[model samples]
Target: MGIVEMNKDGNFPNVRLLFDNDTGIDDALALAYLCACDHVQIEALTSTPGNVDVEQVAANNRALLALCERPEVPILIGAQDPLQIPLVTTPETHGPQGVGYATLPDRGTTASSEADAVDYWIDAARANPGELTVLLTAPLTNFALALRREPRLPWLLRKVVIMGGAFYYQGNTTPTAEWNTHVDPHAAKEVFAAYTAAAEQGLESEKLPIVCSLDTTERFEMQPEFLTRLAEEAGCTESELVLASDPEGTLSNSSNPLVRYLSDALRFYFEFHRHYDQGYIAHVHDYFAAGVAAGTLGYQSRPATVDVETESTLLFGTTVADYRGLWGKPANARIVSSNDPESGFAELLTRLGALARKLDTNS
Candidate 1:
């Protein structure tokens, strides 16, 4: 089969996601979470050069899908560079291959004939009408291209859940901007303004198009034992494997290729957590964003007159305006701040076990 065969309804869900990944540990974790979730049907994946090169990002994506036993899923290669600015990468944070020290498989074949990611997105949105949700995790280049192809897209998409921007939160890339949004501020502005204006017009689809400068994913942290369990169940039970992807001590720019390889790198990725953030493991931020895309989690949202200030000295990029009082403007996006992490993670680990067994048998 084809993606169509996997669609539960006659048509795919409005939840069409686009990932311009750096191939970091969270990206892999997010991809695995999306694949394992039955509710979220990924229609397409698009890679960009941010943390890892475009080729490696694509390769990592392939290895991940194969590891999940869903290589048949379609993917489209994305732009080699950013929309307007020079490519900025973070090898120190995302590691050499973009994940924790992990291994990747060979790239076999293109999963889709729609090679141009922007065109693929445009066609998908047009074909699906008001049912296409664009979940962007990395940058906004692909989204900008899509809008350039069809100006009405901001109004047409079911929603756009973006995992970018830094509000009161300190920036991971710089003092004021987040990596994803800062990479392409022009594209971010277009997307932000388009969706904001559309919601002001009471467009139904715009009611949830723009999720703001929010990162609610800090709530979902997996325990060190959980990471050990995932690797152990994966048959790589050595404590070394656990230490490698520890999310703490694992250097973002490890020289050992196999240390951050996607296949067995989860340990080092987890180890990095022990060094940077609190505890031995980091929260699943992007993965939780994927959960919102799957509709598996609940959200509480309020409408506001949102704007991106192009002139803030500190926030040289755009900044969403202070939450204004109740206006007729619709809610183009939602923010999910909490979840049953214990139960949800347990469910995810359980599914991983089944998937691991399936891969083992097939191998």
Candidate 2:
């Protein structure tokens, strides 16, 4: 099928994205962008133990959705650790309690007690069959397990857009790999093989998965003016909203302004990155993945046999593709081709600002 066009009524394809997060700032930004889209319908979210604890991730998802006035969205907690490797979280980047140490509002949103991330994914895919697109923004462990449990998942899936694995760009987590895939190399290997097989068999249309790695997303940065405007439109000081989004505020009973600001601003990610890997203010990677899923960001795919090397510490968890002579498939995944981040951020500001204006007028 071609692009799922939004009808006159503004209804688009029903999407079921399974998130494996630890409540990082970019995750919140991505969730906000997803909720803002008019066509895409989010079916559910499954949190994992990557950036923070599973509980904290689930809470952050609910809290952010609530802030967006989308409390109807359901959140489910997923695996506490990867399928193989011991979980290594980036506390400095997301703060101690995830969510960049933002103070979250007192919203008693309950989480679904799914068997596991894998089970939840399997059931959702089986239920939706051939209509659901699985956008994995974190590790592929949950997805790999789900596929193992239900080997026919690819047959049911419409597409699988992942946000892991570095090809042409330097890795954020290591010299050869992205964090999500790096966390569970075994799972990543299985998932890559499964999807590649599906594509070769013509089970899925987009054989080459859309990967919004650091190389592309790092280019899209947030302008300070946009943050200032968002703070103004929210009818509260940016400091206040940031405070409300903090997880530690509820858990540790402490408050910090820098933490709160970091919780909401994707630009501040560099502060943590510099400490961990000598990185700087990168774009909101996951949110841009959502943008691609929504068909706004364009991407070109090169068809090649891709695999994840789970062995060799130097190459472990790294994804590599053999594209010696084959021309890869063209895709709609928009890898930012050196555009003005300030301009791109301005578009976001204007779009959200217009939305705010329309809401105010109706009120």
Candidate 3:
């Protein structure tokens, strides 16, 4: 299927994206990467509660958009808590504010009280069928609710890229579950089941969701040197230095605002990883997901009949993928199996650095 649309003047193809995330450090990086890309038009942002609370997530998104000079983009708050589960915010992982140590500029509320995220998804899909790609970097809460209201979502949108699950890999949240799915495994299960139902209704297998599980996403690591290179690319007089030897919660003092914001954010991530003995590097899970959604990164995937385990007490949120034909089920997702981390990081640095340089020039 043609994922992008050509301009009316026959110039070039462009992508229209609807972004959903919880606005953690990696999610912020992902959003920044998308904001930097010149070929994609961000239609709107929908915030969900995961890394932090819903209100804080919306504030973080609005602040990031303002920093990117796209504050006019609409933002809607998603489900307050995961269905059938209490809300669990990870301040330990993402700091109290969910953006690590970075400070947000626009702290005003952007949560649309009257508007609902599920309605937004359904309406957007109905209005722009075959022209919208949804990048969901959070729990499957909102999208799952939308699929309940509109079961044809599997065939309505061009693509659905999700950043969750940990098939055949160690989880970051639990021994068998990723954070996003752990927060709302029931929602995930419903999403996959809906897709399976749609497949039975003649939705092509290629239209299934693309799953960016932790097994592949963890490959995209972010070293501190990348930030230094990005600062230099943005023509900052001060190099962005985030040494592991520095104290916890160190801040960035780069000349460029974008570099400084990112430096502060990634510094906390480096510290978090180091605290857990995972080295001073950050596993940029959502940035890879963002690249996958943007169609700017190369990856290999295999079709899998995916399911979520919600009833097991010991395995509360485990994601099970039937790679073999033993399940006798239609494939519900394309599990990303492999990716090149070196090239992914390079692409992120180049695009974000260019945007930073442009912003600096305009300022």
The sequence of per-residue lDDT tens digits that candidate 3 reaches over residues 9-81 is 4222477999999999999999999998888889989988899988899999999988888877889988888
What order do you get sorting by TM-score, best first? 3, 1, 2
Indicate the TM-score of model 2.
0.78
Q: Total clashing residue pairs per candidate?
A: 44, 19, 0
lDDT of 1 by residue, 219-314 (tens): 577665665455455554343234433344443232222222333455554555566765566656666566556665444444444444455567
Q: What shift in Å separates residue 113 of candidate 1 from its native position after superposition?
A: 10
- List where candidate 3 sits over 4 angstroms from the true fold: 1-12
Tell me which residue pairs clash in candidate 3. none
lDDT, candidate 3, residue 78?
Answer: 85
- TM-scores vs. true structure, each candidate: 0.79, 0.78, 0.95
- Tell me how far the alpha carbon of residue 254 in candidate 3 is from the true structure, in angstroms, after superposition: 0.8
Error of 2 at 279 (Å): 7.9
The candidate, 1 or 3, that scores higher on TM-score is 3
Q: Please report how far candidate 1 places residue 173 from its true position, in Å.
A: 2.5
